[model samples]
Target chain A: MIIDFHAHVGSMDSIGARLTADAMLHAMDAAGVDRCCVFNIFHADAAFGNDLTARFVAAHPDRFIGFAFVTPHYPEEMEGELARVFDHLGLQGIKIYPPYFDRTVEDAIWEPVFAFAHARKVPLISHSDGRDPLVNPNHGEPQMFVRWAEKYPDARIVLGHAGNFRSGRLSSIAAARRCANIFIEICTSWREIGSIEELVSGAGADRLLFGSDLPLMDPRIHKGRVLTAAIPETAKAQILGGNAARLLGLAA
Target chain B: MSTSDFPVFDCNAALGRRHNRRVAYDRPDDVVRFLAAAGISKALVYHPYAVPFGTMEGNRFLLDAVAGHPELVPQFVVSFAVDDPDEVRAAAEAAGVRTLRVFPKSHGYPFVDWIAGPWLEWMARERMALWVPLGRNPEVDIRDLYETARRHPDVPVVLAGAHYSNYAAVWPLLKALDHIHLDLSRFDAANGIERLERHVGLDRLLFGSDFPEVDPKPYLHYLRHCGLEENGLRAICRDNLERLIAGERAV
Candidate 1:
């Protein structure tokens, strides 16, 4: 029943900086996880599309879930990348770390990727977590997500950390109630003043997905956050994996 | 467990006389409430007021208030640059202080020099420890502490509130020394634990909260979530702190 949706198999494999395919599977077996969505770092430019992630999922089809690491900044490969990722790599969805690309969802260059994801029903998982004036401030505001939801009404774009660092902007619960299309990934932002309640009240329970920005952070901690929550079992199931299953077209 | 559930000994609360958001010990009752919520039985607290310059009022305020609050274990940072050995001895005796905390103003001169030979000798003689608070705006490099540790083999030099996980410079020096202890006073996440344990080994690491700002429940929550062995978790949560506390003069 435990499915970790966000985990990294980094460029170098170690327990901290890298959680390679084999390491992830072994850790999963040790930790009692049924499945995990494995992501890869394919260099800075996004040159190689899902090579590592695909290889891992392909090798362990029963255990691993794949997400395509696509660069919308590379405008030419939008549709081609989607087809390649979904068709060739067997990725269930697309993972776009836009801030790393220095691009935004509103960029004219990002249109084709959004369109392709919507058409094929592939979810977009990305990070919106950042804050503090001196360092990396978060790029995706809840309102920005609301705008995207309004634009791509059907596409399931998951914003990690319940759109945290953006929590600085939530000011109050009223501000949080603005976005809907954006599902919140429960991982890093599961700390103080955050939980399934905040997500449910702000963005509805269906939009909240369970994620563990694992190996970088531990899954046991992230899993415990979901497992020991004061919410209903149905809500827990939805956040943990049910919603991710539906988005990835996995049989629920 | 609630995020606010554990007993918190905030290693780094700057006492802004009238506490707003920044300081935890500003409201003594809040400290009591924080410990109660998180199941933290006790805490080792530091006051922000005396740290950079070494004032007695904030240390006095904390130690006195915490005395009534048995849950709070207060520590004073003795001045690094005492001109007189008698004053150094007097200050050490006066405060019943744990660490002669230093400020690396760089130009703060002779004071910086004071810690290495005589003051360090005095500190070692008194059996009081020397610690530098590593949390500041312009970060004090890990190398500086490593160098200081190099010069003084007999004196125990530790870095309190030293949780810079991304950096790698401090590792070798930490590994080289048997006496050096790193109070992972602000290990905000559970995931960072495995990496630290791998590098520092279990005994050298101590559990400290930059509490009130960091709720104890998150640590306890990290305890619930970390993929560490039961003994490792127990060491981090209670036993590691006990190891450090056992060495100190609870005077």
Candidate 2:
């Protein structure tokens, strides 16, 4: 029951991630992953990305769980887009990239999206980094999620990448500890040793979810991180799929 | 083949502690136990202290720490600014050290030929491998690395800690240079290992964990499932590094 909580399905030539449905399926099969929550964070046009995600989910609904991508850049259309993503496209969750939108997660423009997720009882996953020089660290800092989780207690807000580095990971753990609704998704090139154990110890294993950032990163490696962690088997089971299954409302 | 069956020899691992983060395995016994748990047979270890502190002290500490642990091979850190090249070479010979790591960015030195030429020449002559990590702030200048490796063609220069973001820069260097190799600690690009195998062949790819900073199991698992032949896996997981340490050029 390995469900990758984070992954992307569209091509972003800038990052050399020209990922397709077949490629995702091939990677998942090779890594022995049962399912993945696929989205497109690179798409500037939110509807276009959601359509692509919907198409992937339609093609392989059993294996791919579609998550809708929406940006705060289109403020007026955000509510309508959320409706289309949920009612029309039948996407399960929401994905946000604050760096791409050039807006911090704590900005006023995101209130509508957060409200929508809260109303729908759907989970929202956003890109979060800790002092990364490549992107504006404030755009998706783990600490930013604390206020959002406090504001919308019902919405499950996941800090993607768990702040990326150690400082960010520590911030993420703190954020998760502060708010039960805020979860941590572990997936980054910064494969810090003892990170999983730290996350489990700091923010209970139930709050941690497995993610690969697929088509950019490998699922095998991320899954191997959980499988080989020095934590208890029950914690590993929860982080690997049980927690994600609970979040996605899927039978584990 | 299963990942456990692969004869993994980590080429880029650090021993000793750093000030910034709490390393789980700083002691030799802890490193050995950690490696065994991760299914790693051997590791070429350097001291994490070498980057912040002087290489002389760090290298000495590393040699003494791994004295009783045969599985932990000592990889000395060297800096042209800090130590005399001739003295470093003499000590390396005395210690029978086969590999050396350099931190140009952290040590605040340019990795150009003029500053590094003497060391590179000795390394080339002795058939010793040079390890360059890309994990530092501001990173190792790709052009400087290219020039250094190009100048020292005989030295088997290993570029370690290169993440997938470095693909566009690193892939070309590997393609153009036969002596250049990649350590698979942070090279987590999707299908990256397969792509590297296709472009440069498995001979230039080496297995590494960047341990105490990174876990080894994920990398081992990645290699086991990366769709390579057993021989290719063997080359990357163990044979290539074994060859590099033994001063054998890539065939």
Candidate 3:
């Protein structure tokens, strides 16, 4: 099963990324993707975006796997929403956007969600681009999450986009090497040659997951990076779906 | 090993040390092997140092390194640093080089008419190809380069590493001029290839991998599945570049 661990559905206010569930399904079918673990695009209101996500997933359960969007700014109601999405709505994981809120991944505001996800054994995927000069540079730096990883040993944290920018993949690899809990997702506009190989060599094949950043980027480009990698087919299998399935506790 | 059903000629490949990163292409053989591994038939290459350091030294190394490798055609990196017009023209002619790449942003020079005026005239008179590195940096002025191409209509100006956002600007320029072309190394925006082919037509489009910094396999894979027709794919892959290269020899 080829699973895209990172994708987006619904409108984004910031950069104008809008992809409907029908559009997402068409793109997935074209790209030969079996399932997509999707989240709402970046939004200030988590509830509104999460509602769209829940409806999208509920409509196409087999094609889409939902990840609930939560923010620390809503600290008063963050945990309640997390339970409503994951427990009631049947979302599989939690997605966090730190740079959008002008906060770093290591901020204390994330402790409640982190603790909850740790206890629940759900993967926490965060937007971890090393670019974005407007925001704090450390906002998505994979190294910033090491302390959190050490604190919450059970939480499976994914650095989405693998710190998506130039030379950011190396930092993501470094972060994965430092913390066993952090896995790197390969989905970014920047496609440095041998980047996937570097991730496989620096971090194990098991610590890597395939992501398309879909609707924003094509899934085939990300998938081709793995399918044509010089690595063995077994490693490609792990990257394409096995590792992501393992992370989500699904049959590979 | 070519992924596409059609043959491809990469227009924006590079050789030698890449700036700010560890690249696989250190020697000419490395680039040749890299292209061969990707099943690419031909590539227009340059020494990465030619961007930072002036072209005189880097071009010499590039010409020598790719001497025997026909698959790797050397694209001479020239800039205003070599002020003498005769020297630049003589070096290109002696080396049998057809294409010249300029990096004003990386080489720390302004792309003004005074600096490029004589070269532009020389390129037009000689029918040489002028490859301007654009869209890699936000500060790169594609419109200014478009104006420069307007000054010398005879010279074929190829915008290497053009961003997808600049594709809109290409039509207005292309409507007036036929010498302008866009290299698709960094043009990976969603539905980018299909849209460009529809709006600008495939005749002006050229295949580019930006190798050494990026792998060619993915780009080849991308173009293969971008839903282009066989003739359109053939034009982008090989025919368009063949015309460009042939124009150089016809000079």
Candidate 4:
């Protein structure tokens, strides 16, 4: 069973990427991915985007799992949105993209979101990329997430993209090693020859999860990486689905 | 059927020690060995140190390091700021260098036509290929590459290491330029390769792994499962780059 822990739904005009449920289903089928954790793509209305995700996941519960989305800029509506997503929509996790609001995961605005994830025992995933120096350089740094991991000790915080740059991969590994709560999701287009090996060695196989960033990235790329990595079969199994299954409270 | 049925030819690979502690395959032999083990039969490689340091030293290091391995082809790194255009051209010709990569951003060279005019002319005359690893810095923008390609129509230019962020600008360039080619290592956009193949011919796309920096296995899988025809798959995985390299004229 393969579980893609990172994927986006809805249209992102900023990057010219858009994916509907039908398109994602086709992509999943093509890549042979069993399940995927789907989330919103930071549209104009965060609440509406979450509703779209909820409906999409509800339509295909067996194939898709929903992760709630909340724009931290609207702190007043965050609590209500979280409640609606979890209680009404049945979304399992929280996803925060820093670049959309130009705020880091450790920013004061995200404290409530972090606190909620800790209390609920649901994993929190955030977009982390160290390559975008031109814009939002410090927003997704691995060190920032490490600080959050230390602060929110009980939260299962997964750093999405695992630092999507040549130099950032080391930072992700180092950050994951520094905090046990921080798990690195291996996604994005960038993969150092032994990046997965380094993650396994530093953070253990249980701390690494497979993510495709689908619609933004090809699922085949991430699947192929795990399948072809020099790591043991046990570790590969954990990365592909076992780790995510445990996080989502699903049967292994 | 296994994905390893066809041998791959990676066009953008790097060798030697890096100043940063990121790379897993730092040694030249290890780069070749790992690529071969990953089912890549041939690779065009450049030394990583050459981009930051003088290109002359890096080129020499690359030639000497891959001397024993015939499957590992040497791609000389050239910098107009450090090396004289005339001397570098002569040396490249003498060294049997068919393909050269220039890092304008790292080497502190402007991407204007004047700076690259002589070198571009020399490459065009020699029928050699010019590679630019774009999007590393703000200066190495895709627009500047389009301008360079516009200036030198005869030169076969390959843009390597381009990310999806530059695809917006790259789209127009793909439509306009015939001399332009793209390395498929960082082609991560959703259905990007398919889109590119539709918008531009598959002949303009070349297979690359960004080896030592990134693994070749996943990219090999991407090409295999990319849903292209058998001939299109062969062209991208091997034939296209082979044709580009074969265009290198000794005279």
Candidate 5:
């Protein structure tokens, strides 16, 4: 089964991304993706984003997996928001964006979220970019996740975009090597040639997950990277869906 | 449609190593083998050296690298700041180079008409296509590129590595200019290809991989499954580039 580990639903006017549930479903069906992990990192109110994600997943429960988005901006609301996301919303994972909050992933403000994920044993995915001049590279660098992964070994820490560029990919691979809890999601505008293969070889296929950064990127393009990577079918399968399935506790 | 059904002619690919990261395939033979494995029938290849190193030597290196590989078409990199326009034209003619790429930002030259006019004018005369990468680090200024392409309307300029972030700027460029084209390597905006087909039509879109920096198969898969008609698919995946390289303006 093909599962996209990253996707967004909502109108991000800043980036001109407006992905409704219907549009996301159409894209998923067109790309032959069996399931997707949907979230909204753009909404400032954590509950609003989770509500949007929950609504998107509720429309197509079988085909969509809802991931909760919480920010360090509302330190007081983090715990309660996460509980609502998991308990009431029935969301499976957590999504964070350090760049948007203007805080690094390792900041003291995110400790509660990481601690919550560890206690819940749910996956935590965050946007990670290295050396991208467009955004502050230091905000979401993959290396920052190593500390969290080591601290919260039970929590699945997926580096969204796998650090994005070359330096970021290398850092992601290094972080994944250091922590078994760490996973690399391959989705970025930077379609660096041989990146999938490099990620697999550097961090192992089991540690890599396929993501499209949907509504802003195409799933077919990211899926094609895994399908055409010069790797074993087993490795491809693992990266494509098996790893994500294992993280989300889905059927193999 | 399966990927094999479409004959892919990658219009933007590089054939040498860069200083930043290790590429999977850098040699000509490896690139050919890789592209063949990826089901690409043909590719317009430039050297990474051309951007960082001297254009004349880089172009020479590119010619030497793709030597005897019919599948790998030579794409020379020209810099008006470094190489004289006449010398470049003469070399391109001698080498039978049909496509020329420019890195105005990397080469430290303004992409103005006065600086690039001679080279672009020569390209227009020869019917050789010009490739400009918009998403590369230190991106090509869209305004400068717009002005340059506007001044030299005859040059079939292909914008390479343009991703979704460039949609707002690129959309107007496509609507305004018939000669301007977009490569699909990094144009991965959600349903972007379909949107472009509906708004701008498929004639201005061309298939490119930015290979060795990007994998081509995903884009091939994207084009095949993106809901375009077969004729439109053919235009984007292969024929459009052939037309542009042949100096035919968009219909």
Candidate 6:
């Protein structure tokens, strides 16, 4: 079961120059992805937030797993907005774009959102690639992710694109062992010299999530890379679909 | 151990501080392992941190990583941190380095201003080869470099990350440099590999994987399935990188 965790399928107007929904779905079909976690493009569209994408995912529940993207920069409305997505649209997870939203993963604005997710047992994910150091110095650093996990131990946090654009080193992730809920997603780091294997070894199988930035990269190879990785089958299985399913409360 | 076959030379790898924390690529062993699994026997690795600050710190770390294991990675593209042509030659001579590479954006320096001018002159004069990455973000001013190359009439500059979208942007520039080469990194866009080969003769293009960020499998799959002539594949996949690093010291 190839559940690609990072994908966006919508109009160019919504995604601001991306594959159309049908085109994205066809691309997914061609790539042999059975299902995908859907999110909106990180942009400034007022109506194109979690609610729209979550509703889209709800319609194709079989083909898509829904994730709502929230702007943590707007701390005042984060909690209410998150509640709207999860409660009204059945969004099991929330996607955070630090670069787009211009806030570090560890900002105080996320405190309420993280608390709500922890209370609701929904997960929070970010798009970072260890590139952005401060993420948004005007806001905060990406390492502030630790504070989220540390503060809300029950809230699961996912760092996407294998933690793109300003993620810390593996050792630092290891050092922050207190945030056991923190998981890393492998989407953009397919052919990367470093890999999710290092993160899996550092954190554990339980903390790794599989994502394919699909319609952007090939999904077959995305699944193939994980399956062909030098890890045990159990870990591969977990990353492929198990972890996401269990995280989303799809199975007991 | 030809780098072109299952090549693992990562072009777009990076380094930086995050949240008052640093996610650095100063570690060499891990890099070696990374290249190895990417099925790369040798690599032309670059360091983002060292280039911007004009520090040899990351480059030296890479040198140390492949010091004893010459078989693992035999060559690297010398970063533009070395200023003096005498010193650049000296450092390459000292480290046994060859094929200098420059990151126009990561270092936040216009290639023309920083070494592109004097450096192109040196490369032309000294018969040196350089890997110039061209992309949207940092925005390679190919017009400037190509114009400079025309004036110098000798430096060998190869385009590292040229994609289908912006290849046209560099079209006017490509005319000036008889020696400028383009590698097949983002072969996904229209007129991808097959188209590029047909448009520009096979020899002008090289193969590279901007790894640890973009996957090589898709690019490899594209090339393998693109139905290029075997001669074209051989030229791109192995022959070009081999020739670029051809006369350079094996150490």
* TM-scores, all models, native as reference: 0.81, 0.93, 0.87, 0.89, 0.92, 0.64
Highest lDDT scorer: 2
By TM-score, the better pick of 3 and 5 is 5
Tens-place lDDT per residue, model 3, B223-251, is 77777778778888888887877774211
Residue-wise C-alpha lDDT for candidate 6, range B44-88, written one tens digit per residue: 655554554554555565566557755333233444434455766
TM-score of chain A of 2: 0.97
Candidate 4 residue pairs that clash: none
Candidate 3 clash figure, as a count: 0
Ranking by DockQ: 5, 2, 4, 3, 1, 6
What is the docking quality class of candidate 5? medium
Model 4 TM-score on a 0 to 1 scale: 0.89
What fraction of the real A-B contacts shows up in model 3?
A: 0.36
Q: Which model, 2 or 5, shows the larger TM-score?
A: 2
- Which scores better on DockQ, 4 or 5? 5
Per-residue CA lDDT of candidate 4, range A137-245, in tens? 5788787887768878878999898887745677888888888888889997667677788778877898999988878888888888888888999999999999999
Model 2 ranges with Cα > 4 A deviation: A130-137, B136-139
- Compute the DockQ of candidate 5: 0.62
Preferred candidate (TM-score higher): 1 or 5: 5
Tens digit of per-residue lDDT, candidate 3, span A27-139: 67767789999898466678888888888888989888999988777788889989888888889998888877767777898888888878898899988866455434668
The DockQ scores of all candidates, in the order shown, are: 0.25, 0.62, 0.32, 0.54, 0.62, 0.15
The per-residue C-alpha lDDT of model 2 at residue A70 equals 84
- The residue pairs found clashing in candidate 5 are A193-B213, A193-B214
User: What CA root-mean-square deviation does each model show from the true structure?
Assistant: 4.7, 2.4, 3.7, 3.4, 2.5, 7.3
**Best-fitting candidate, scored by TM-score:** 2
Interface Cα RMSD for all candidates? 4.9, 1.4, 3.4, 1.5, 1.5, 6.0
